[model samples]
Target: MNKKWRWTIGISSVVIVLVVLTIIKIGTTQGAKPDWYSAWASAASSLIALIALVAAAVAANATIQTNKTQTRQLAKLEETQQSDRASKFAVWRALHPTRDSQIYRTFFHNAGPLPMYDVIIHYFVNGHEYTSKEETLPPTSTPELVKKSDNNLEWFIKKLAIEEYGLYQPKTKEEVAAIADLKKRAEAENVRIELVRAINEGKNRYVKDIRIETGVSFSDGENTWYRAPNGRLERTS
Candidate 1:
């Protein structure tokens, strides 16, 4: 029960017992009982009541403390569960022939117990870094490719030509020959791709990076990227 009720009941009980003892003491004193006997009995009764009050207070305090501890433990367990569920991975893979330009797709699936938040995929193609332009993927969900046409394909084509043929430009008479050589070299070289992502899981955050490599040697599919399990061409006609 509450402290006020406990105190009231305890005081009433002590007072009742003391009154009965006093009555008995008076009766005995009239029949030769020592005068100090009544004094000793009253002191003993007061002491007993004080002890009972202290014990009740202690028990109530202990119950309150136990409840607080249990509450903290339960909160901790809930946080742990959320963090576990939120664990996820975002993989970047190149879409082969989905569009005219080679596009990379960032796909995510929840690998842990909690939901993923702000799962942004940052990628690098041929040494230039680029962030995903689309919204972050949620838990267990795979999002569409972060469309990037910022980097001009024509500029990249020229760079590839310069790197392979060691010529930035060709004369008008040799223009056809240069064009043929660039196309031939571009088909033979592998495009270097790298992917990384950052994700928020509750109060914590994690960043991860994966190496992107061609599936085979320098060939037709060598320029494409793919994530494990399901990174293939998805025709969205």
Candidate 2:
């Protein structure tokens, strides 16, 4: 089963055959074997030994090549695993409502070790898709805040509360109904969001399994940004 045992068996078989042939030659010549017969048998034994050596060399070379291939495959697998581990990103949201003012401050946080780039949070409302403006969210140690009202919710609230005269005031019955319907649509849809980062060579990384309540729409003159998942801002790609 092993190389040593196989070599031992092959060599023993060859030696046994040589001894048997020698004995036969010597017997047929009545204990005085012809020189040519001995020479032919020696040549045959040498040829067999050479064949065994070549076979062993071939087997050893094949084994070495196989080991090299396996080593390279293992190294590649480890590299892929390390890349996955280092590139993982997670998005988190926290609601910090001020008790006195009833100002609902919703903070979107990046919870992973890696920095997230072009982190567009996508939300679904009544089967329609909306996305947050592409932004970079640094790692957990350096949290970024999103002013929900200024950036997102207040627009809807203002359009509803303000009359045609443009004075800011409380919402009328119809406005209240519209706001309630919007809230219902948002909650009913559950607003699944995607946080994505695109990189050089068109490679993309996404923060998986996190959901947010709202999505943003980018205006015509918005800025696009990029960053490496593990490091500082990447100015290109």
Candidate 3:
């Protein structure tokens, strides 16, 4: 038999043996044996039974306590993982300034005009740099920029929420002039330029996935938030 069943049978045997010994002693004391031996035998059987019962109770309680400890430990581990994920989300939100890129991203998911946003240069290809520029989809405006790019794989975005993603604005003549003046004063960093277009809702529905497409440099897996050249949430790619 199994170890547990063996233990149970052994304990039962011990109890039965004690009871039989007690009965025999009682009978002998009334006839052949002395009264003192009978009394001692009865006391011994009672003590053994009490000890066995106490041991069994302790064993059962110990098993229950161990199970409870394991359950609590697992719960604590899950809570810690959830807390870590939440902290990461907060960090990303602080770093990525979506509002500075465009006003629509700052307020609501506008389905009209695209908001201008910023992004760091992922890298330069030839003379152009790849960046995740901020783009917006303003409400009431036709999101033709994205729709017409259906043939263009590079311009495809999964979903475009109004005011959700940011937009990128081009460098103005004044800004370029400022850059020239700054070069005469001191050589500043060269900024990359990119185009951002707004997307329409339900226009090109597909597999039901919308990704943040600032340009070639966009990384949805990035933990960091992007910023624009104008010190806004949006940046040119």
Clash counts for the predictions, in order: 5, 2, 36
- Tens digits of per-residue lDDT for model 3, 79-111: 554333222211011122344552111111223
What value does the lDDT take at residue 202 in candidate 1? 12
- Please give, for residues 32-91, the per-residue lDDT of candidate 2 as tens digits: 677767666777678667767866876787698789999999998976554442333433
- Candidate 1: residue 7 Cα off by (Å): 23
Error of 1 at 149 (Å): 13
Tens digit of per-residue lDDT, candidate 1, span 27-65: 575767677666767776786677677768767886997
Reference-based lDDT, residue 75, model 1: 95
Model 3: CA > 4 A from native: 1-32, 39-43, 53-60, 63-173, 177-237
Question: What is candidate 2's CA lDDT for residue 11?
Answer: 81
lDDT of 3: 0.39
Alpha carbon lDDT of each predicted model: 0.44, 0.47, 0.39
Candidate 1 residues lying further than 4 Å off, grouped into runs, are 1-32, 88-109, 112-118, 122-237
